[model samples]
Target: MEKNQKPLLIILAFFSIYVIWGSTYLLNKIAVNELPPFMLAATRFTVAGILIFIIAMMMGKSIAISWRQLKNTIIAGFLFLSFGNGVVVWALRFVDSGFAALEVSAQPLIVLVLMRILQGKKIQLMSIVGVILGLIGIYLLVSQKQILSQENSILGMSMIFLCMLSWAYGSIFVGKADLPRNHFVNTGYQMLMAGIMLAISSLLFNETWSSPWVWSSPVQLSVLLLIVFGSIVAFTSFNYLLKVVSPEKVATSTYVNPIIALVLGWYFLEEEVTLQSIMAAVVLLTGVYFINTKRKFMVFTRFFRS
Candidate 1:
């Protein structure tokens, strides 16, 4: 690929990540209604991991990593997938899928704070502005009458927030950790380790093989689509984009996902899309744009003045 073309590809990869991951929230809501959260997530990741690993092996990719690297990947996986996505699946059972999606979309802001506190990186002013706008967006999202009326809304939102935190922590750790040179191979290992951990957690907390057999065909199909689209394809695209783009640019997918999720929820679940939600989405997107684009704007200004 040409040098310039790489960026275009990365942009497309980011678009895929946003659309596919947004839809996963709604799919998760459907799947969890039929299967236990942990179990569903375990199965989803396990199947997706196996498929990815097999594909990697068939492509003559190295699946071998040092034990130390494997250990780090495992820990990262446990924190990111098992806790982050696992908690998301659990939260969807109690919260509206759109709400869950909105909450999780705050991951980039969480990542900004995590990077500052843990790595002692300087927080950029634009990122601070992004966080403020994102928080306001979150507030507007949760202010819906349906959400406010739910008795467990606080607990549910808290779980989703924790999910964002766990994901951000894992992402920061992974950025700092030494891993295999190949992103695909590293992602496969992470998924496998995370799947094992989630499977064990599922067994310990909510073991039930019977429900999988009893669920309707539509539910089974939804789970299958989630494994294929959400877990495998979206994750692989995200990993590829991470290698090709700046993390901040890749993080813009977070802002795009909530809008997609909102549309999906309205179409499939008949969820109401209020004006407040639309305004929140716009604010969140505007914040993301400013954070990602301010530096570019400065560069363009300098060029024009010269």
Candidate 2:
């Protein structure tokens, strides 16, 4: 690819990651209405994982890895996909998809804090401000929901928070672990391991058989979209973005996804967006901006001071 085309491809990849992944929140909402949450996630990921594995094999990618590397990958996969995303899918049973997306949008802030503690990195002043702003945004997002009426809301939100932490921790682990050189193969293995973990957990939780064998077309379509576009395509694009762009730029999807989810939720499900949600969105975006661009902000601050 030419240098010019590289930029275009990166942009396209970012766009797909933003839109397709964001839409999965709404899809999860639709899916869980019929299928059980854990079971639904298990099926979606298992299918996506198998497809990715087949493609990786056809591409002559080696699935073999050192035992240590395989162990680490499985651990990361269970933490990130099985627990992190699994919690979000499970929470959609009680929360609006848009709100759930907004909740997970706080992952970047969580990551910064985790990085500080785990890697001994300095936390910038702007990142501190971002976390403050993000908390306020989260408060506004869930304050009015009927879901909050139950004790389960507290439990659900706690699960979502843990999910964020798990995902952040997984990202850190992935950065530190030694894995296969081929990204596709690594991702395929991770997804496969995560799918197995989720399925096993679903069985343990007695979430295995809640529904009829009959499938609804809407739910089936949602599952297909999630497997093909959300998991396979969006994840591939995201991996590509990590190579071509700055991690900060690729990380901007954290900010973009909630907006996409909110729009889709409003349009498709007629979910109401209040002034509070708008304000929360602004605060959340501002927080993410400050967190990601803190170095640039500090540079400008020092330049002006000089």
* TM-score for each of the candidates: 0.89, 0.88
For model 2, what is the alpha-carbon lDDT of residue 181?
60
Which pairs of residues clash in candidate 1, taking residues 3 or more apart in a chain or in different chains?
A: none
Task: List, residue by residue over 226-245, the lDDT tens digit for candidate 1.
Answer: 88888777887776655454
lDDT of 1: 0.77
Q: Candidate 2 at residue 109, lDDT?
A: 85
What TM-score does structure 1 among the candidates reach?
A: 0.89
Q: Write the per-residue lDDT of candidate 2 for residues 1-306, one digit (tens) a residue.
A: 225435555667878877888999999889888887888888878888899989888888777888987887688678768998887899877777787788888888888888788789898787889889988887877786554774577777778889988977776676657766666777777778888888898899888454434768888899899989987788767655544444445567887898889999899988777788888889988888788875543452231121
Instruction: Give stretches of model 1 more than 4 Å off.
Output: 1-5, 211-213, 297-306
Q: After superposition, how far is residue 169 of candidate 1 from its true place, in Å?
A: 1.9
